[model samples]
Target: MTTTPERTEPSTTAGERAMLEGWLEFHRETLERKCAGLTDEQLRTASVPPSDLSLLGLVRHMAEVERGWFRRTLAGEEAPPLYYDDADRDGDFHPAEEDTWEEARATWQAEITRARELAADRSLDDLAARTSRAGESYNLRWILTHMIEEYARHNGHADLLRECVDGSTGD
Candidate 1:
């Protein structure tokens, strides 16, 4: 049984790095909170008939995102996709139907841990090894903000997915 990551998102506002970390942590915790107490089946249940979205899928998706951003792009490591493939780009969310909540949560937590470790020694101004869709390189500060946005958007979906799964909702 893997232990869940600590989720004490800082309440006190601080510097730019601290603020970004707090918001990112808050978003990560929101995803974990939505998945908490859910059965594997509940976590795998899709939001709707046409939509493949689920709590488990979101967790997997975020894990992939974290690895891509922090390891592949930022760290200049030869990191490959953890879930998806060239033939099946959305594999992370699609094949998640059979994923256990425990497995998905553990993988997500591990990715989060790795991302924190990668970013610890870097400054906000550090440049990434990858470029954005616009063909422009970005910095750690941008990556952090992008991560916050990514999780925030997905967490909103998680809100609906959780509510749909069990009618649970809150901050």
Candidate 2:
């Protein structure tokens, strides 16, 4: 798979914004690169152990994750969770056979676009003004850091999943 181009934050006077931009860029590129090349069947295929984790599922889950962190939590939307059913938290990673590739891809693309548009205009110093999953309040700084950590954790999962799928490695 080819690595997506790195988007080093522009050298602007807005230092905080630059940092947040860089973090978002890194994670976004990481995810896009992880999904590079693979048929619809491949995207939905699980690893040898029969786990439910699939590339398509990961994309769907990450889209939901991005929405949760950057949009809902940061924007203080008080909106309900996306694709998150309390009864089955693991549902994000378990793709039904009926799930079409177009649906999954479109959902991910929409979330990514929304995140970029929202974040592009704001500085990290600009308060996101939202509460955490635990109901704790947080600023944009905390949210960006938490998102970076979340993406890193999932990239590790992507690495393993990619290796299992095609023996590919590295960004």
- Using TM-score, give the best candidate's number: 1
lDDT of 2 by residue, 5-115 (tens): 454543546576566667766776787677777667777778657577888788778888878876786776665655658888877787777875678778877877877
**CA lDDT for candidate 2:** 0.73
Which numbered prediction scores highest in lDDT against the true structure? 1
Deviation in angstroms for 64 in model 1?
Answer: 0.5
TM-score of each: 0.91, 0.79
Instruction: For model 2, give the RMSD to the true fold.
Output: 3.4
CA lDDT of each prediction against the hidden true structure: 0.87, 0.73
Residue pairs with backbone overlap in model 1: none
By TM-score, how accurate is candidate 1? Answer: 0.91
**lDDT (Cα, tens digit) per residue for candidate 1, span 52-135:** 888888999999999999999899788788789998999889654456877877888898999999999999999998888898
